[model samples]
Target: MNKRVLRIYFLISIVGLLAVYFFWPKYEKLPILETVSSFQLENVHGGTYSLNNEKIKLVTFFYTHCPDICPMTMMDLMKLQAQLQKEGIFGNKVELVAISLDPENDTPKVIKRYSEGFSADPLGWKWLRGSEGDTKEIANSLKMQYQKLEGDFFSHSTTMFLLDDENNIRALYDMAISDNPIDTTKILEDISILIEGY
Candidate 1:
């Protein structure tokens, strides 16, 4: 009877350990898709922002006057910004970049107001605008296509990029899905993997 009880307890312990290992959040080391081309643009705060940095970055492209997709993406990012802030990594270990596709219209003042509308913190979230040619160059490198439509509108790709500290494109997340625009939980897990140097 004593031996049977000990075996049963050992089996239960093994099952519990296996459950934890399989069910607990696991962050795999993300692959380096490609190195991003270094670019510099004007931040909304009147400062120059560069892609060369020693911090993880989430990069997206948008225009202040975007009708639907851009605004929705920003909303999702605002939620992500809060999570990163709560984790105490925002602005320090991780940064968010939103580059303007409509640089002509998204001037410093315009972009600043847009950022404010989303409650984007300048310390961690950067709203950048540059010349049309420069903006196209960066967008092309990221495989983000955009075409100007009539009267302050654009048809653009709704993809968000995740970059490691070394400016390597690590992952791409879709922002066009209506049901789930951004997977904050998955992003946070990936960020943790990068932060842990996995």
Candidate 2:
């Protein structure tokens, strides 16, 4: 081919690639990981709360006595909560749930205190505890594993789940990373995608 023709073709190819890169869908619909069955647990404030809902939810399993991962996760979530609240979607479109793994000891009162310590507003953040059997049932369904250690301590999964409005698990986030526990930026994007029906 002539040099001029080759140069023109290369320029066209570069422009096309740039167009695709810039105009392609950045955030596609998040895949549904699993559909969680509805389960009711005692809310920290008072009445029972069910997982089946129309609002986007971020759910994590933790115990009040957790020395490291649980509290750290809550702190990370607190940051997210502030951002969501600032955006005015904290309770309306998105909500957070922290279910107690040590249900026996994490009573309503204890969970309430824990929630307050993190400044977890009940309107947007729910602290839930149920019977041992119920807790295991829901945790197993969500694939969250936990085992009691000693003296109110327990080893548990450090994963948090993001669920769509239809109760489908959309994404899982790691809370065990020492340097970067939760990717709140990605999470906020995912939540926005879900809210916007993308």
C-alpha lDDT values of all predictions = 0.90, 0.90
Q: What TM value does model 2 have?
A: 0.85
**Candidate 1 residue runs with Cα over 4 Å from true position:** 1-28
Q: Poorest 10 consecutive residues of model 1 by lDDT?
A: 174-183
Any idea how many clashes model 1 has? Answer: 0
Residues 1-198, model 1: lDDT tens digits: 699999999999999999999998675569889999788999988779988988999999999888788888899999999999999999999999999999888889999999999999999999999999999999989988999989989998888999999999998998845656788999999999899986
Indicate the residue-level lDDT of 76 in model 2: 90
**133: Cα error in model 1, Å:** 0.6
Q: Estimate each model's TM-score.
A: 0.84, 0.85
